[model samples]
Every structure is written in C-alpha cells, then in structure tokens.
Target: MRPPVEVSVLILSLSAPGVFITMNNIPALQEPLPILGMGMVVLGLVLLLLLLTVRNLKKVDPLFYVFAGFSFTCMVFLTNALEQDGFISGFMAFYLKMGEPHLRTAYAVMTSYWEGVVHLLLFLTIIHRMFRGKSYRSLGLLWAGSSSAIIVHIPGVVIGKYGSNIQPAFWRNVPFFLVPFWAASLLFSRPREMPVVTADKIIAEQKKGLLSRPVDLLLSLLLLGAMAFSVFRGFVVLDCPLDACFTYVYQYEPYLKDPVGFPRVMMLVYLFYALPLLTVFIYGLKTPGCSWMLDWTIFLAGAMAQTQWCHIGASLHSRTPFTYRVPADKWWPVITLNVLLAAVPALLALRCHNNPTYFLKPVPEGQTINEKKKN
Candidate 1:
C-alpha cells in the first residue's frame, strides 16, 4: 500500500512551502504585542514586594508567588473571550492572529471564560488563605487538576487540527504546560490539614453501610450513570456502527463528529481516564476507610468541571458549523445531561469534604487506648 518514494517526496515538497506561506499570512497580523513582557514585569515586581513586605508570604511556598502572578492573567483571558465574541475588539487582535491562531476555535473561547472566572477566583482564594497563614492545599490541588486538563486538551486540539498553522508564538504555551506538573507535585507533597475527629466518630461513620447512608447511595448510582454516559459518548465520537451511536452523533451531539478534533479527544479522555475513577469512586463510597477519595474527589471535580464547561459551550457556540452544532430540538436534553454529568463529581467532592470521618482511617483499638492513657 505504500506509495513510491519519489511520489511521496514530491507531495511533501509541494505541500510544505504552502503550509509555511499560509501560517505567515494570518489575517490582522501585526507587530508583536508587549503583553508578555508587561505581565512578567508586573508579576516580578509583585513577588519582590511580597517577599520584602509580607512576613507571612515569605514563609509560604515559593509557587504561591507564581500563582499569585498568574492570577493577573485571568483578566487577560476575560478580555480575550470578550474580543472573541465581538463584544469588544483589538484586545487580543495581534495575539490571536500571530501568537495563537487556534484561539479562534470555539473550545478556546469557552476555556478563556473558565480561566477568567473560575480559575481567577480559585487563585485569589488560595492567595488570600496563604497570606493569612491558612492551609490551601485543597484549593491548590483543584487548580492544578483543572489547569492540567485545560493545558493538555488545548494543545492536543491545536496539533490535531491546526498543526500546519502553528506560529512561533505558539511555543509560549511551553511554560503553561510545564508549570502545572510542578505545582501539582508541590501541592500533593504538602501536609493535609486533617480535621479533628474522635476515634468514636471515625468508627461510627465507617461502620455504616452504603444503604444506611442515603446520600452516598445516591452518589454511587449517579456515578454509575456518568460512567455509562462517558462510554456511550466515547463510542459516538469514535464512529461506532451501532444504531444508537449513529443517531446520537448526528441528531443529538453533532459536535462530537466535528473535524476540529477537540470533542473527539475529550470523549476519549473521559472514557479512558474518568471511567476508571468513577468506578473507584463507587467502590470508595461503599467501602470503609477509603481515604484517597477525599483528595481525588476534589481533583476529579475540577477536571470534570473544566472539561464539561468547555465541551458544552463549544457544542452550543455559534462558531461551530451549523451542521455540527447540537440540534435545536435536542438542546435542552443534551445540556441537562451534560450539566448533571459535571455536577455529580462536584457533589461527591462536597460530601467527602463536609463529613470526612467516613473516609478517615479507622482508629486502632491499641492506639486509642494509648491516647487515652496519655490523656
């Protein structure tokens, strides 16, 4: 099936020059913006001021300065989103044209809003807590998970669809892609601020069966449903031959079939990564002393929230070709299902956080006696 070497070489030679020319001819391209330099200066000055003036901030993790600086970019994200929607203009004109042509994609627009609103608030909250000498490991992990998901999917889509159009400035995402991993490792290594729960409380909470806890039972069922939905959508995006998949893709979620590749990659992510987590969450709810659920639930909630926000918004946005956008008649049902999918993980995180005794390690009888003797 291989083509002749001469023919293959000829084809590539012919196409490469055109790709370069197209990339260089981006509409509205202008002289490079100073935004990047300005941001670095601003963040550097803020960090220096904090290190000198704020005694509490000096004791905080160094990454706190980085995040505190990154939070300022959230406003830039909001401006980009507004410009993309035509409510404003010129804010991101040069960047969009030369820096990241892929930002024109519907998915990127939604992601911008998410970073601007949700991520901004998260960073500010963590910064405030850090300044007050409070533990913010949970919030930092949430941000880490959310930012990681966004960084992964956005670049995947860019290379998937706009590989030929990539410009030099696109490489600026290198830091964005790398920093989350560092931040995540640092946050995970931090000591958790464990809640005060007596031995009796841990024993009582862990002793209860799943059926005895109505909320947990409901969450288990909802997570099972989410797992199934994730699989079904994975099939839809993969172009399964089943009647349901065919009908669902065309009539309900045409965006899954878009050639842009974001939706397809996103579904695959859900199927491969999220499905296993959902099953484990169900197990965690039913079993006692599943301490991992507390942290993982928050992490999963952040991932699901970020992914669903971008996916749903992209599916409904006007930029999606009319043929690929969700059908008007199916809009409400589709939105409801996707919204609930995103909400289930959030609820699980809340349940684990609010009453974590069930997820805590069971107290050993000998250890409890030793503690009593010490008292």
Candidate 2:
C-alpha cells in the first residue's frame, strides 16, 4: 500500500486544482461588464467633477476621494456577493489558480462576502461625508482597514502572473489591479515630514532621547524583530533556502508554505510592518516634532492585529485541507508572535502618546519638509 501521506496527497490531488478557476462561471459573462467597469469610471469622474466644481470637495476627507474614484466599487462588491463572480473575484481567481488553490478560495470568499460588507459600509460613509460635508470620527480605522485589504490583494495578483496559464499580458486585466491601488494611495497618503525640534532644543525641554527611555527601547526592538522576521519569512514564502536556525521558527506551519495563507499574509507584513518599522525608526521615534505619528501607529496596531487573527483563524479552519494543517505543537509560537506584532505597535503608540517629545523628535538637519511629503 502507498504510504498514508502519499494517499492523503493523492486524495487531495483530484479536488485541488481550479477551486475557483471556472471559465464558465465567469461573472462578466453572466452579466456583461463594459457598462459596469469603464462606463462607471467615466460616470464617477463626471460626478467627481461636478462635486468638485459645485461643492466644497475640500471639506471631505482624503478617503472620500478614494471612494469617489472607485465609484463603482459598490457594484463590484455587490456583483461578487450576488453572483459569486465578478471582475475582482474572477481575476483574483485566475491569478491564484496558478499558485496555491486556497488563496483563490480565500480571495473569493473575502471578495464575495467580506468585501461586500466593507464596500457597502465604505460607500455609505463616503455618501455621508459628501452629503453631510463632514468626515467620520473613525477616519483612522477606515484608512487602515481599506489600505490593508488592498495591500494583501496586490501580492496575489503580482505573484500569480508567474508560471500560470493566466496570460501575463497587461491591459487585459490591468484595470482590476490598478484601481485598487489607486484608491489605496488616496486613502493612506502621508503628510510631508515636519521639521523636528533640534536635539539641543529637546535637551532644553528636558525630554530624554528616544532610545534612552526603557519603554521606547523595548517597543522599538520588538518592532525591529517583527520586521526582520517578516522579511526572512518572505524568503521562506519565496522558497529561498534557510539554514536551521530560521526554519525552526518560520517553517513550523506546512500550510504557510502553501500559497493561500503565508504568501498573502507576508505581503501585508512586508508592506505594513517591515517598511513602517523602518519609517518609525528613522522619523517617528528618532526625529522630533513629527505629526502625530503615534496616532497612525496605534491604528495600524489594531488593524494588523485584526488581520493576523483572520489569517490564523482561517488557516486552522476546515476550509483548508488536511494536507496543509498547522501542527498543534507549533501553535503557541505563531499566536504569540502575531499577538506581539499587534501589541507592540499599540505599546509604541501609547508610549508616544504619553510622551510626544520622545517619539516626534525633529527631522535631521537639512531635511526638506516638501521632499519628505513627496514620499
């Protein structure tokens, strides 16, 4: 008899391919897209022009601009929810089919229901802002949530184009990918780095150096560790060989190596965690008098915490196959690390909030504010 593992793999082999890759089930085919996609863009732009020309568009928040730009995003969400097929669901399905099957399934589920919910609420919020001419208090949460969703989706589309039957040609599927990012950029645009109070000034104010504070040192190091691990794990997701020390931690989960979970999650980790940590180190903590960087950091902590919970919860759930089950023995490390990922940011945010002078130190001498804004 074949080994039990081989039998299990063989059994899964029959059901695995094309979990969400059915051409016949295409949503656009079911309900034509020309009027929906490009037409909506034209209409949205027209309405946007009207809103800008007639109304004080400046009164609205930046995220409102994203919603206005992605005017038909509600329809995309609705189409996916109703028909279980649409541009987003279809394109992501095709893309994920090339790599891990679970990612397609996850993307489909997220786009279908989760997206339906988010897009609807996001639409309402935008309408509220436009009509009411006021922004919601939950601006930070809105930015973090919307940005994280698009952040995860990007790596899937990018990596899926490799080695799959999915045509690598642009233009064919470019709109679906570009639109999300364009919206995301609007939602999370950063301000120009403000000039920092000089170190002499900080000393004059009797504020301690960022690293001198015990709490700041600990939180900074904690985020540093998370960033390093995320990059190292990216190598694992990319199948870069690692020596024993690294694998013992990151390689614990078999399903993580599967395209669906680890790869998608890592994309967020790299974009959100790794890069932000470096930014915080350079300007947030090291420099003085930056904008309320701590406020954004706090919101990110909550957002990432929620994201990890979703990733971990979904992975262990029955939807994923036994072939990629997370080993129970390895559970603590995963959960603990993610919890830390979530908590450390909050702690840093708290630390900064409590002592603004420490976290918002002045930018380095000769650093131009407009140049920083361009970033």
Candidate 3:
C-alpha cells in the first residue's frame, strides 16, 4: 500500500489539476494572451515540481514537503476554478472539494495559510536546533525575521485582506529587511571574547570573501536601487502629482484601466530583489565549509518564489476588471525550476541530518558530527 502521506498528496494533486485547467479559462479568454500565457506556464511548472516532490517525499523535509505539495495543488485548483467560474464559484468549489475551506478561503487563501504554517514550522525547527547547540546568534536572526513576519502578517489577516492594502508593500517587506539588519547587529553584538575567525569559519570561505568591501558595496548599491524603486512606486500609488517635465513618469502610472506597465515593473523589482540571494547561494557553493548555507538559502528562495507564485495566481483570478495577463499553462515551468532549486538544498539539509558541518568539517571529537548535531 502507498504511504499515507503519498496517498494524501496524490489526492490533493489530482484535485488541484482540475482547478488549474478551469482557472486558465478565465485569463485565456482575455486579451494580451502572451503575458497571461507566460504566467500560466510558470505556474504549471511550479505545480509539476510539487507533484514530483510528493512522489519523492522520502527525500524532503516531512513538514515542508507535504506543505509544498498541498500548497501548489491548492493554488492550481483555485486558479483553474477562478478562471473558469467566477470568484465565488472557484472559492466554493475548492472549499467543498478539498474539504479544507475553513483552513483557507480560496486557492490563494490556502496558499497563504499553508505558507504561514510552513514559516512558523521552519522558525520552530531553527529555534529547536539552535537551542540544541547551534549558535544563539543565528537563531536570534531567524527569530527576529520570523517575528517580523508575524507582526507584519498578523495585521493583514486581522484586517481580512490579502495584498498590500492591509500593509503597504514597504511594510509587508519589513521581514526581509530583518536579514541585513541582523547582519549589521552581529558586528556590534559579538562578544569581545569571541574570535572574528569563528564567524569566518561558520560561513564558507567563498562567502566570507564575497562579503568583502567590493561585494558589500555592490549589495549596498542594490539595496539602494531597490529602495529607490520602492519609493517611486509608493509615490505613484500615493498619487503624487508630476510636473510637466515628469509627464513621462505618469505614462508608467499604475492605476490606469490597464495596469500592464505596473506588473512589468513589479516583475523587475522581484528579479532585482532575488539577485542578492542568488549571489549568496553561488558564493556558498564555492565556500569550503558553507554547504549548510546553500541549503538554507535554497529553502528560502523556494519559499519566497512560492509566495510570489501564489499572489500572481490569485491576482489572475480576481473579478476586478484588471487584466488577467498570465495564462494558466505558464505557471508549471516556473514552479518546476523553483522546486528543483529548492529541493537540492532541502535534500542536502536532510542528508546532512541537520548538521551544517557534515559535508565540510570533520567529525568532532568523541562523537560523529551528524549525530552530535541533531537537535
């Protein structure tokens, strides 16, 4: 007999595909077919990856693997239903079909609810492991970040809104800001007795080197660019009037009947934001003792990508006259790449048995490193 988890995942997967097929009908029937098509293509790829992961559940983090598979299934199903039927139709269908509407309202609702569950679980896992023997500093960083997410996210939930209206984009992104904030805090918080070399030791040499002046400068520049773009977008959202000379800027306005330009710009923002994380991952791969970093980074990237994917899929399904620019089929490819990218690190993390140093460092004295490292 198939494992209980596998059987559950299969059921969820099958239910979701039907939703996806239906969701596509909404946007496929709209104009700007290419844009919608690309979106769907990306979405489909993501679902395929999740389905594959379910088939290989033994290789993934039990909590995350299950959540990921279910999350994608929910999204595809919701999107399909929303696109084919109206919002109420899709929402009711998934609610009744999946037997979990109370857990989440719509496909996007399911995605957000599960995503929150996953993050909380990850936070707990990190904390549990850290308490076992890992550094308080790393745990502290995660705690701070996760706590920020809770703070920012709770307001949105309480207010009963999904997107930026509950918490503006700037406020919604505050959790991500915690990473750099914590990094800076480390420099000041390090105990006088702690050696600088140990910090270097924790990270891979390649990453250590990449965090040097030039790389730091590049990161700073990127941050600044992101901030500037955010400010610009914020201003536009606020409806700050433009002078005659700035009339060109108004051409890129976001509140127009057709806001195609806004999404395109937002896509650019996502790409830029993703770059630094990607850079760090590349650096980790080259670092001697930094394999764990690679795993963590991969997990984070996948989670983040999944978050975005959920939003995009939801947006396509909304009843607002706004363009349903993304086609249904496109989502598959994007999700597939995201899963592969994330799985590498997750498998590595599991194989290392939660030991960050297993692949890079020799076993510690008196115990096998992996066993010793278990939380």
Candidate 4:
C-alpha cells in the first residue's frame, strides 16, 4: 500500500492536475459556460460578504486590502476573457483565425485594452506597497522606474496597431522603460532588521514553548529566495530582447504545438507567478500567527483559475494528442511526474504547520530579543 502521505499527494495530484498542468496529452476541457456563470455568482456573493465583514473586522494594513482588490480585478478581467472566448461568437471566431488581418486587428485592440488595465492596476498596487513605509525619494525613484518601463509599451502598442514609423519609436524606447524598474527592485530589497514579534511577546510566547527560530529562518529564506527569483526572472524577461525572442521561438511555439510542452511551460510560469502566494502560505503555515491562510487559499484558487487560460490558448491552436486519450501505458507516468512537482509545495505547506522542525532553528535568544526591540 502507498504511504498515507504519498496517497494523499497522489489524490491531490490527480484531482487538480488541470489547474497546474500546462502541456498534456489530455483533451483540453472547453471553458465550462455553466461553471463560469456560477463562478461569477459566487464572486459576487463573496464580494458582498467581504464588504460586510471588513466593516466589522479590524483595520489591517490598507495595502492588504489594495492587493486583494487588484487580485479581484484580475479575476474580473479573466472572467471577461473567458466569456469573450467561450460565449461570444465573433470573439471566438476572431481568436480561432488569428492570421486574418481584421481578426488580428480586433484581437490586438481588445487584448491591449484588457492587458493595459490589468498591468496598470498591478503596477499601482506594487508602487503603493513600495511607498507605504518609505520616503518620497525612494518612492520617486520607483515611480520614475516603473513609469519609464510602462511608457515603452506606448510605442509598442502603436506599432502593433499602426505601421512602423520613422526613427523606430517603440523599439528604441523599450530599454529605457525596462531597466530602471529592475534596478529599483534590487535597491529596495532589504531584509527586515526588526523582529516580527515584540521582545516581551517573544518572552511570553517562549514560556509556552511555541516559538521555533529555525523554522522561522528557513521559511524566511525560502520566501525571500522565491521572491528574488521571480523578480529577477521578470527583469530578465522584460529587459532582454533576446530573452523575449527565445521565449517566442522556443516556449511560445512549443506551447501552441505540443500538448505536453504546454503544461511544462505553464508549470514553470505558475511557479514564478505563484511565488507571492507561496510565500504567504509558507509564512502562515510556519507561524500560524495571522489569518493569512484564507488569503493564501484564495490566491491558490486564483492561480488555478488562471491555468484555464494557459490551456485555452494552447488547445485552441495546437494539434497535439491528449495524453489521457492515449493508452495508459504511454502517458500516465509523464502525467504522474508533472502532478508530483505541483503537489510537493502544497504538502510542505501543510506539514510545516504541525512540524516546525521542518524549517531551520530559531535565531539566538539575544539576537531575537535585540531584533524585537529594534522593531
């Protein structure tokens, strides 16, 4: 018999493979129209609940609320995309025949409008977070960087819509817009010099033997590494024209052709995109101090919703065979491995809650006390 843990992992793996699977031999599920409708209803109910609950709840950092709002807006855009692609004949027909000039033009217009809104909101949230506790000098630098990078899209958008102009405006402006945002990220990433809990609180909590320093350090390191990797990759992908070309050639094309390759790329992309939620999960599971579990779960749900987008793009275009449609002998193992990779972090998140030793040792007592006092 499989170990209970292994069995649980396997169950999770199969149950939600589509949520993380990018490229697979399985037939891509059509956008469930009923499910989408139901989801919108549920979202509406949740929003109403949030409005009511927050009024009675403590005033936590407004940044958290801002992030939540951005996340919801992203979901709204995603739902709109789904409705357009799934229910609207004109939109679906246009996307299906992407090579058509008129369709391409329409797609360019609609996609640009939606993407611009999403990016603008996301950028605003990030900027708001950066400026929350920092000086205007720091905020100004970030503003200059993010704004400059975003400005490059203006020419790129124009070029996509109109014929190339004199002096090659968009192409020339791209780098100036990208470089500073990356530079600002590196400049801003300072480790918290203060303790998360107060010195008195730590002493009080220590009496209960609840504080585990090693676990805290390990979780912190994991979160920091994940965040740093994501930001670094974002910079590399955004700033390097060569990286974009390679992505278009290798990752993008394979995604549209090979079913298996689609999931692989998607898994990689989600691993990056989900880093923030993963960090929250790690911290919450390790500490169990705050009520971020709900937030983490919601983020995970949002990530799962996004997997549909990845599969929709590939399935609509690709001619690859579905793995599940193939013989059990051929594709099950590949599916199994992909599922395992996706399940590992979730299991780790759960285990960390009960086993603090899963992470590193606590900071030295004197250091912990000093840090807490400084904070």
Candidate 5:
C-alpha cells in the first residue's frame, strides 16, 4: 500500500519508517453508505441532456462542460458527505466510499467539501459569468482557488490508485481530470480582453503607506528572493543531485525516485514560477509606473496563492508517501515559509491592483512644461 501523505524525508521517504503524521483521519463505514449511487447517475445524465438542449448549443464552449463535469463530481461527493455515510454512486463510489482502499486522510474528506460544495458553487458562478460576458478578472481568483483545491488532491489519488491496487473510484474522476484541458483549447482560441484602466484613478487608497516609498521596494526585493528559492527548489525537484543541494534542502525532505503525482507537478510548476515571476517583480520595480503591472500582479497573485496551497496541502496530506514526508524537525519552518510565499504575492496584488493609482509616480500638482524662448 502507498504510505500515507506526509513529507517525512527529502529523498529518503521511499524507505523511511512509517510513523503517524498529523493528518485528519477518517473512519471506515462497516456497511455501504446509506444511499443509492444510481440515482445520482440519472441526475447527471438529465443535467447533461438539459444542457445540450440550449438554443445556442453551437456557441457553447466546452469549458462549460468541464465546469459541469467537475461540479457533478462535487455534487456526488457532497451526497456522500451529506448522507453522513461517505457513500457515492457509479464507479467513483468504490474509491470514494468511507473506508480502506482509500487513503482516508483529512485532505480526502475535505475534498468532498471543496469539490462537492465549494467547487460546485464556483463553477456555477463561472458559468454565469461566461453567459453574461463579464470580465475574467474575477475568474482569476475562481480558477486558481478551484484549481488549488482540486489539483493538490490529484497526486494523492493517483499514487493511491497506481502505487497500490486501490481503485480510487477512477470513473468518478474522469471529468475532473480531463475537462479543464479540453476547455483550455477553446479558451486560448482568441485573445483575452484586458481589464480596462481609467487613467490614474488615484484614490486615498493609493496613498496607503504599504504602497509608498521603501516598503514597496523592500517587498519587491523580498518577492524576487522568494521566487529565486522557488526556482532552486524546482531544480532540486527536477533531479538536482542531493550533494549539490543538500545545504539548501532539508536532509529529510522527500523526493521519490522517478516520483509521480505531487512531486512531479511541483518541479514543473517551480520551473514555470521561477524566472517569469522574478522578471515580473523586476519590471514592476524598474518601471514603477507601468500600467500592465497591475494586471500581471493580480494574475500572478492568484497563481502563486493556489500553487503554494497545493504544494503545502500535498505535503501534509495523508496520501503522501512516507519517504516524501517533511521531517518533523523542519515541519513548522518549511510549511510556514511556503505559506509566506503565497501570502506576499496576494497582498501585493491586492495593494497594486485594487487601487490602480497605488504605484504610479505622482506628478507635482500645477506642473506643466515651461516654454523655451527659442528663435
């Protein structure tokens, strides 16, 4: 069986002793959950049919379906949770039912609330926006938040299913895994409209001390350093030798050999995160008055916020392999630091984007160019 989620070692978890890590545990139900799986199946089919009947079906983007599919999965899990029996229907019920063959970690249980309840609502909001042709600014948060909640959980299920003979109720996860990808094609087919700027909508909020003087400069420098560390971490993940990275990485940090799931995704995300984010921060500092800075910061904030959440969540998750667990000695420091990585960007984004005038170089009042007496 795949050992429970917890980062116990840097590269040694594969052979580390299994010890109880602090994860939320779930108890197994002696009997099947007190509900019918088939009923939900019928409801899903009916919802799909109803969606298909829309008059503008041709104009409907596939992202809608991705949203629908994930929402459906969320609903099914909600059913399991609400029944208070951890039961579900269709193929997913087998993997998701409250008991063994599942990791039964708190993260797994929380997924029910995140996917089944929160994601369900978020998808509906996104769909409402899509239909209304609203700006995607709000969508930045929705997409990242939902992605964080779900993406972090994926490696857990994958390792559980493949590492062990655990079924994972794979059928239940089909739409959750595939829908966003298919929808991405549709999303990128055209250029996205940027948020409209009202030139220098400076407000008292813009004068907030956080965005003034040395504070902004210090924060930018700090963010760059953090991103640099993130890049180094990614390198380690992509196979930087332990001897080369030992000084930086905890001795007990887990790195699976040919690691799959969370470790793999993390390495890739770090590479993506490292350089561009640093460049963004640099560009903002160098061109303090740049208009595009606000938009970039906002989007990056969403991306970082969720990424760190997923990273930390995966590390603490019960399904995490023992070999990969963060040793207890470094747990608080590591987890707390990652938490900071998420927070700094979010706060910066809020300060910069929420008030467009927050970072612009203010012109002196009553200033106009003096006319030169030239002949």
Candidate 6:
C-alpha cells in the first residue's frame, strides 16, 4: 500500500526544499558544476526515495517514475526563479551559461515561475493520486498540453533570436520535450471519465444543432473571433505591411515586434497550431460524435493558459525593453484580448467536460435496441 497523504507530503516537504537549501549554502556547490552529475544526483535520489517508500511503485505505471523524477527537478525551476529575482545566486549561473543562455530572458523567468510554483503543485497532485491508484488521466492531459506549449515556444525563441548562443546543456530539453508526447499517448489511451448516460440521452443530445445549444453557439462565436485574432497577430509579427497590421503592431501590441522573438514565435504558434484547433473546435461544437473535443479542449486549455501567462507577463515585465512594451493607452485593450485568448479554450473545455452527452458517440439503431432490451 502507498503511504498516507500526510506521509507523502511530509516526505516531499523535507526532501525537496531541504536538499535545495542545504546545497545552496555549500560554497563548493555554488561554483560551476557539471550538468550531468547534478541531474543524475537529483533524479537518482528521488527515484531511490520512491523505491524505498512506495512498495507498489514498480507495479504502478512506469510513467510514474518519469513524472516523479521530473517533479523533483522543479527544484531547478525554483532555483531559476530565485536566482532571477536575486534571492539566490551563482548556483545556476554556470548551468544557464552552458545549457540555455536564453534562461536569462524575461519570458524564461516568467516561465520558470509558472513551472516552479503552479506546475510543481500540479505534478505533486498527479503523483499523490497515482500513488493511491486513482485516475490521473485528466491532469496528465492538461500537463501534456501545458508542457508541450512551453517546450515549443522556449525552443522557438532560442532558435529564432539566440541560435548562436545555443549550448550542449540545451540538449537536456530533448527529454522534457519528448516525455509529454509519450505521457499524452498513455493518458489518451485511458478510458474517458464519461458519465453513464443512456443511449436515448446520447441520441437526444447529439441530435441538437449548434443553434439549439445557446452556450455552444456563443462559444463557437468566441472561438471564431479568437481565430481571427491569432492570425492577425501572426501576420503582425511576420511584418505584414498592411496598414492595419503595421499600425496595430506599433501602436497596440508593440511587444509582438520585440527583438527577443518570444512574442513573435508565440503568435505564430497560435496561428499555425491554435488556429487549426480553434477551427476544429467550432466544428466540434456544431457536429455530433466529435468526442475528441473532450480531451483536446482540456489539452488546448492547458496550452493556452501556459502560453498566455508567459506571453502577457513577459511582454509587460520590467525586464522587457520599455519601447517593446504595450503602450499605456492600449494596455487594457491589449490585455483583455490576450486574456480572452487564454480563457476561451478553458471555457470550451469546461463546456465539453461538464455535459459531455453531446460529444458522446450516438448509439446506432441496432445498439439502442439491444441496450433497450438489456435494460
């Protein structure tokens, strides 16, 4: 049996921060260190603790080891945040220089905060539930999308603006990028947490068109608007010389033109990736049997949440050059637009999850008869 929740919490509390703080105080540790040695020690210790404490750890999903090990590395993320904020120093300077010099960017600092605090807590919750043999598919999918977005834009900025500065330590992100795809496949393979509705109910829900579902109709419109906005910003970043794109890029979201390239790559991600998804979302809303919406919406919601958080925060952060920041006159409008971009997918996900009958597969006439007879 797994340990009680309190025991797990207590163990983590003592292990993660305790080790980090102790190492921070060591003058020798503060010096430049080999990334390989540090990574092995952190992951090895966490894996060792799990082996000793959780008896059934091996019997549980093997992915547990992958996630749990990654979770402890949130300490590195925390270290990044602390070092950036000046609460601690030197520990990560060598690693950042050798691995990802772009870590010094404003967007990366905000990304560190998100990963350290929010994503760390999320991983812990997932680990706790997994320890107890509970379903963590939903959370897994969310993290999959969130992590995928981070991995994409982070690399995009590095290649787009800092290509010359790339280092071997940067290759460490290869696993971080790949793990999400593997975890997502595992999560999607799990049966969905669908309510046990009758065939009749599924048929009735699926029969209704988009207009009949006022909420879905509204959501579809919002998604369309968001799609347009995504493409617009994408063009703005690409230097589309149209009057509106040119004017808006300069006067409104000047951050899109930031030389650092994070915002530019972000908008392109939305355009190329999110735009197609948004189009499919509208189709899912109008059509029946699009059960994929349930998972993808949650996935997109997570992606949008992480993407917009980094984009919005980094754009206005004091670290961003003032000339590239959103103009004061346009701050509210610009923020509102970006906030809506993040929020719409989340709302769509909630809609699909809350009343999934519409997205549930419609029963064939023969199956409905069989089910009726069985009932």
What's the lDDT for residue 150 in model 1?
Answer: 60
Query: Candidate 2, overall lDDT?
Result: 0.49
Clash number for candidate 5? 22
Best candidate (score: TM-score): 6
Worst 10 residues of 2 by lDDT: 8-17
lDDT of candidates 1 onward, in order: 0.76, 0.49, 0.39, 0.37, 0.51, 0.78
Worst 10 residues of 1 by lDDT: 4-13
**Candidate 5, overall lDDT?**
0.51
- What digit string (tens of lDDT, one per residue) describes model 1 on residues 53-92? 4454225568765575556556666767888899875456
Q: What are the per-model C-alpha RMSD values against the true structure?
A: 12.4, 13.0, 14.3, 16.4, 12.8, 3.2
- Greater lDDT among 1 and 5 belongs to 1
C-alpha positional error of residue 47 in candidate 6 after TM-score superposition, expressed in Å:
3.0
lDDT of 6 by residue, 203-261 (tens): 88887888899999999999999999998888888889899998998898888877777
The TM-score, computed over Cα atoms with residue i paired to residue i, of candidate 3 is: 0.35
Candidate 6's error at 179, in angstroms?
A: 0.5
Q: Give the TM-score of candidate 4.
A: 0.31
Ranking by lDDT: 6, 1, 5, 2, 3, 4
Model 4, span 1-375: residue lDDT tens: 433322222232232223212212212322233333333454465445435534543553333332333234333333334444453222233212221122122222233334335433443445344435432223223233223323323433344323322222123324335544454444345332232433344444444422455545554565565455444434433334566545532433222223233233343454455666666665554553443342234334323332432333333332234421323343354334334433444444444334332232244455553453445
Clashing pairs in 1: none
Per-candidate TM-scores read 0.84, 0.58, 0.35, 0.31, 0.58, 0.89
The candidate with the higher lDDT, 3 or 5, is 5
Query: In each prediction, how many residue pairs overlap at the backbone (N, C-alpha, C within less than 3 A)?
Result: 0, 8, 35, 17, 22, 0
Instruction: Give lDDT tens digits, candidate 2, residues 11-82.
Output: 322221232234325545222243234334554554455354335334544545445434344443344344
Ranking by TM-score: 6, 1, 5, 2, 3, 4
lDDT of 2 at 157: 46
